[model samples]
Target: MRSAHHPATGDLSLPEVMAALSDPLRIGLLRVLADGGERGWGELRAPVAKSTLSHHLRVLRDAGVTRTRQEGTRCFVTLRRDDLESRFPGLVAAVLAAAEADGVGGGVRLASDAA
Candidate 1:
């Protein structure tokens, strides 16, 4: 288990957060993180390559939305839940709501066919 103390202010840049959240993969990552308490990178089963997942995690870390720590050779990630809620109330909730509205369950969305 990795422990971290979130920075109250100026830790997460707004632009970086926006950029990180803009990508669907990153959003999926966030959703996954929300599931387990703290997750090692290996716990993720994202369809993308390990390199790609690394990039996404980096983005989230830089954005201050997540705090990562190295435990031995493995990296673990956890959402900066407190800081995030303090910085932007209901933001994460809204995202979760949007996902629910979009019909995503257990972080996976069922596809819809269009004509």
Candidate 2:
């Protein structure tokens, strides 16, 4: 088990969050976590390389968009819905909503998924 560094809600910055979500693949992974439960990396459906996925997770964590917990050799990630809602006030929902409109998480990969 290991602890992943995550920015506190109050420490979240809009630019950082935007940079984190700018990638379509990260947005797709966020959609998976948006379901409001802890999801293992294997369950994320990211289809990205291990290194790429780790980079995305780190971005989200640093931006205070997600929280990760490690148990044994597995890592579980969850969206910080309430924190985001309180700090950014509907930002998370709005982004997910926009992603939905763009076909995110519908098993269709956006172009940036190739990154």
Name the candidate that leads on lDDT. 2
Model 1 Cα lDDT, one tens digit per residue, 1-115: 4454444555666676778788777787777677547887777766677798788888888788888888788888888867888887788888867865774434422122121
lDDT of 2: 0.79
Worst 10 residues of 2 by lDDT: 106-115
Residue-pair clashes per prediction, in order, are: 0, 0
Per-residue lDDT of 7-107 in model 2, one digit per residue for the tens? 88898888988898898878887787776878777665456677887888888888888998888898878889898888888888899999999886555
- Candidate 1 matches the true fold with a TM-score of 0.79
Top candidate, metric TM-score: 2
TM-score of each: 0.79, 0.84
In candidate 2, which residue ranges exceed 4 Å CA deviation?
Answer: 105-115
Model 1: lDDT to the true structure: 0.72
User: Over 4 Å off in model 1, which ranges?
Assistant: 1-8, 103-115
